[model samples]
Target: MSKQQPVLFSIGWNACINCGACVAICPQEAGFVSPFDTIAVDRPCDIACLLCESICPVDTITHVPVEQPAVSVVTVDR
Candidate 1:
């Protein structure tokens, strides 16, 4: 069976620096830098694919497992 895609959310989104790293690293072409210079994701993406999540330098974006309720799982670099 196909794995479910993850839903991405920006936590404390005001902290985003509008760096295009998310867009640049997204192999699924799911994320983009908005005209207002903010990070945005419009397309669906696979949860198993961590390309964007791992590449985000600021750790502003997060994803919830498809099986779980949509919640913000904050990713931080320790």
Candidate 2:
């Protein structure tokens, strides 16, 4: 069975200088730069393209694995 990996992106608000590099480079327009100078990821990403991650000048655009729900195993007590 093949498992597809899903990624969750985060922008380091403190480190982000509002350069708009990521926002401009993302073809999907997934990266947004608010008028208040905040950066955010507005939607789920397929991660097929990493343009935003590659174009972040401050290296603030990053992704971490989304945690999978825990599976419970049933065991019989003898």
Candidate 3:
């Protein structure tokens, strides 16, 4: 049976510095720096390799675990 991969999301262009570190380290070639000066996630990647987060010089890249739920909740009692 084929293994399932995790869904990938794109980091905003403003936060990306166009550093090629993500591209170099990704074994899946999931990360790429576009011509428009933005970092893009090419496809769903479940590599679990944190190279992109570590190699980002500007600290722009962030890899959040998919299983973790958001802590924020809205509660209204009236």
Q: Which candidate number would show the highest lDDT if scored against the true structure?
A: 2
Error of 3 at 34 (Å): 5.6
- CA error at residue 11 for candidate 3, angstroms: 1.8
Candidate 2 residue-wise lDDT at 33:
47
Off by over 4 Å in 3: 1-9, 29-42, 64-78
Query: Per-residue error at 13 for model 3, in Å?
Result: 1.8
lDDT of 1: 0.53
Could you give candidate 3's per-residue lDDT for residues 1-78 as a string of tens digits? 113334354565577766676667656543344554444455344555556667677766654445422224323337
Ranking by lDDT: 2, 1, 3
Best by TM-score: 2
Better of 1 and 2 by lDDT: 2
Worst 10 residues of 3 by lDDT: 68-77
Better of 2 and 3 by lDDT: 2
Steric clashes per prediction: 0, 0, 0
Each model's lDDT: 0.53, 0.57, 0.52
- Per-residue lDDT tens digits for candidate 1, residues 1-67, read 1245555545346767767676676554333445544444443344446665677777777665544
TM-score of 2: 0.56
Model 2: lDDT of residue 45: 49
